[model samples]
Target: MEDKIKIHVLNTGYVEVDEALAFKDKSYNPIAYTGLFRSNKHKVKVPVFSYLIEHPKGNVLVDTGWSVASREDYKSHLPLKGYIASKPILPSGENIAEQLDKLGIDKLQFLILTHMHVDHVDGIRDVQDRAEFILVSRDELKAANKGGGRYIKELWKDTIFDRFDWNGEMGPYFKSYDVFRDGKINLIYLPGHTAGSTGVLIKNNGKFVLITGDAAYAHASWENLELPGIINDKVRTLRCLKWIQKLSKADNCVEILASHDPEVKPHIIEI
Candidate 1:
């Protein structure tokens, strides 16, 4: 039998932030930031996506959407304050549970988190009863526990650690992972935006789909190798972008997909 899989992009909401706010460092050319800021300014629609991967064995979710606590905290923070002040509602009325229901996925087999960012891992609590969570590594989980970034460690305080089965690193290249031997799905570590930030590569029906979670917020950012100011390591972020570009070009089977690209929204096929 031939291997098969289906991919879907779920839109969560939109956020507006100043372009300069995204790049706080001065290592790169200032003119570049100015140009990008001016060209892409209005609230950029950010889709909080939860990808459903249907394999022959079972179904898996790449990342969960936002949770009430994270969303409330984010709304109160300065970084996200402006967008919330404007009262811009999230795009979808359906939460992760409802969305999954619409997809007809009764039970999730696996839950893979790209990182511990609030928007990415917020919905984990919602699906805790249904699936086993797969995180970056034990060290990464430790770092998240340190609690300094936008992600709230307390929110995950009740997480059932025993439910976490995978505990190995992806590789030196950012922090790497190979999900399966047959190349059906591979988790690539593209750290920079966050300490243990990662991306996913899925092979479905001969085509390769690359789901980058905040590795590059927008497709143009990756094309230009532009680093976001909020990132923890600019050097590593650029390296990941370069690698993504090469993969999209040289690896004919691969198609790069950004988690928050507004332009790509129209192309998403809802299942």
Candidate 2:
């Protein structure tokens, strides 16, 4: 019998942050920034998503949406717009726990993070009790701790790492590896949005899906191989985008999903 797979895209909230402000001035071409602003009206409403995957072999979570506290913490960082746009609400009409319950999954076998960004890891505490967290590498945790990573320090204050006895598994970096040798799911390294940003590839019932965590905010960016204005490493980020484009075009069954694209959010199949 063919294995069944269910996927859910849990929306945290809508955000409108300036992409140009995210990076240092003069680090990137003004044309790219100008084009993004011109095309997106100088602002983008990003849909923060957390994915829940259920397969016959195991239950997994691709990313975790921000918690209420974490959302508050994000507000603290943005004094200008923080007060106006800061709250914890899921667009899918259910909290993370409630959503899991609806799916009939009491506990998740693994919680794979695409990266340790604030919005993505904010819901970690909610699932810590019921799942083992998987990250791309220890470098991500280290970057998070040092306050040099994507997530701010205030959001990390209540991380579930301590509860897991501080034991977490990292990486399948710069290469593709099967989560289970049977090849039900695969983690592909596509760094540059962060030091260890990764993507999840799942195959079930003859369909393949690729969940890219912040590697590219929109599918158009991936198609154009356009790096985001606020990337840590320009070369690496561009390379990753190229790789995703190649994969998406060559493989008919592969669907590339981004974390913050509002256009793609509505089309996602809720589990």
User: Candidate 2 on 1-271: residue-level lDDT in tens?
Assistant: 4756777766656545454522324244554433333434444456777787776667888777765454445455433222232223344444466567666777777778777765676666766677754544454566666765245556446555521111213222346656656666777767788876778777766667778888877787777676666677778887887877777775445577888776765344421
- Per-candidate clashes come to 5, 1
Q: Which ranges of candidate 2 are over 4 A from the true structure? A: 19-41, 70-94, 153-174, 266-271
- Cand. 2 Cα-lDDT: 0.62
* Candidate 1: C-alpha lDDT: 0.62
lDDT of 2 at 77: 45
Instruction: Give TM per candidate.
Output: 0.77, 0.76
lDDT of 1 by residue, 1-271 (tens): 3655767676655444444434344344444432343444332334556677776677777777665444455556324422332222344454566677777787876777777766666667767677754555454566677876566675576776432323235433844555555556677777778876778877665567788888877677667776775777878888888877766675445457776676766244311
Worst ten-residue run, lDDT, model 1? Answer: 80-89
TM-score of 1: 0.77
Query: Per-model C-alpha lDDT, please?
Result: 0.62, 0.62
